[model samples]
Target: MELKQIIQNRRSVFPDQYNSKPISKQVIMELLEAANWAPTHKRTEPWRFKVLEGETKINLGVFLAEKFKETADKFSEFKYNKIKRNSKNAGAIIAICMERDPEESIPEWEEVAATAMAVQNMWLTATDLGLGAYWSSPGLIASIGEFFTLKPNEKCLGFLFLGYYDGPNPERTPNPIEDKVEWL
Candidate 1:
């Protein structure tokens, strides 16, 4: 697929759309390679991806479910079940992170922007590969750094859930750019 079409066609495919088939390690490596090429200011290269698959994904589900149970005043069984289901259903879950520069030379936001670009690259690659993918930001995501054994300067941004999907590619209708953009 062409780059323009890939960018416009990319959609947030949820776990329910995912099939049970596993994704090959080579494809995941290609996605990471694409992410690694995203531009970073001052060469900070802040993006860090921690991938979870197989039994480890179940462990992630357990960890998240337990965290939600502890935090919610009245834990909704529905939400808890969905979290557990999504984690196990996904072929893989990649934890997106940003390791801040200790020197603090470049602004913190730049590092975040760089990380986002990296994710965008991954997303586009997934779309091209006919894989379903979505970036999810749960309320308890920030606390994942501890579970992932991240350094003090590193922070979890979100998780990219990936899996094989069947059926025709979904179409997207985006809002016009005029409303959101302005000429100087």
Candidate 2:
């Protein structure tokens, strides 16, 4: 697919829209390889991924539901169940993480931006392959240690839920890009 087509077609497809068809390991690896090529400043390839499938995926859902119940000021069963269900429905869940530069070679935000770019690469690749993918950042991400460990400098950014869906890509249109830009 052309870069413009892939970029424009990419949409955040949730687990509820996904079919039961599984994403092959080879395709997952291809997405990761694309992520590895994302631009990084000062050579700090900050993006790190922990892929969860099968029993691991189920465990993550259970863990998150329990954590949400234990932490929310006023817990809603609906939200709790949705979180759990989404995790279970995804073909695979990738924990998006970033390891900060220990020497502080670059601003922390740069590392975060680079990590996000990596996810964008994965998203575009998923779109090109006719797959669904979503990057979800929940308040509960702060407590992700309960599910996945992180090094001293590593932190969870969010989770990428990837899967295959039966539905066609929904039509979407964004406002003209010129609306937000001002040429000097």
Candidate 3:
């Protein structure tokens, strides 16, 4: 597919739409390679990925459900069950993290922006490969570092859920770009 179409057609495909088939490790590597190529100021390369597959994915589900239960003032069984079910069903879960520069030479927001760009690259590549992908930023995501044992400077941004799907790709109707852009 052409780059323009790929960008325009990219949609958040949910885990429920994914089929039961497993995604090849080689394909996942390609997606990571694409993410690696995203532009970063001063070559900081702050973005980091923790891939959870097979049994690890199951553990992630349990962790997320338990975290939600512990954090919520009034936990709903429905929400807890949904979170667990989705994590268990996903083909893979990638924990997106940003490793802050120890010296603090550059602003932290720049590092986050660079990480987001990296995720965008991965998303586009997933679209090209006909794989279902979605970036989820739940409130409990901030506490992921505790369970994942992330380094002191490393902070969890969110997670990218991935899988294979044969369902219809939903069409997106974005508002006019002109409204958001300003003349120089």
Candidate 4:
């Protein structure tokens, strides 16, 4: 498919049929390569990713579940279990982290924006490959100092789950952009 068409068609899919089938490492590498091409401020590419699969994905699910159980005062057991279960449903999960460029002296927000662009690149690549993907940010992901272990000044942005579609993409009716544009 053309890149432009893929970009327009990519959708965040969460459905009931996702199984344990695994995506090959080569495809995952291609996704990262696409992300590596994203534009960044002052060429300070700040996106960091940890791809979790096999046993590691299970461990991550358990870790997130336990962290929520420990830290969320009002945590629902159902939600915790759902996260654990769904984490295993995807073929793989990519942990997205962002590190600010200390030498560049740019505003932190720019780095975050660049990181988002990186994720979009990855998502588009997945779409072109007919892979299912979604980006999710639980509250704990943003607070790297909390449940996740990170180097100084590093922050967890979110995780992207990728797999072959278990079912058809849901019908999407995007909100009309008539009220979302401006012309000077």
Report clashes for each candidate as comma-separated counts.
Answer: 0, 0, 0, 0
- 38 Cα displacement, candidate 3 (Å): 0.4
TM-score of 4: 0.91
Best by TM-score: 2
Taken over the whole model, the C-alpha lDDT of each candidate is: 0.92, 0.94, 0.91, 0.83
Q: Could you give candidate 1's per-residue lDDT for residues 124-154 as a string of tens digits?
A: 9999999999999898896686477998899
Worst 10-residue lDDT window for candidate 1 reads 139-148
User: For model 4, how does the per-residue alpha-carbon lDDT over 63-134 read when each residue is reduced to its tens digit?
Assistant: 788888878989898989987886788799898999879775788999999999999999998888878888
Per-residue lDDT value at 98 in model 1: 94
Clashing pairs in 4: none
Model 1 error, position 21 (Å)? 1.3
Order the candidates by lDDT, highest first — what do you get?
2, 1, 3, 4
Per-model TM values vs. the true structure? 0.96, 0.97, 0.96, 0.91
Better of 1 and 3 by lDDT: 1
Encode model 2's per-residue lDDT on 1-184: one tens digit a residue: 9999999999999998988998889999999999999999989999999999998998899888999999999999999999889998999999999999999899999999999999999999999999999999998899998777899999999999999998788779999999999999
Supply candidate 4's per-residue lDDT for 136. 84
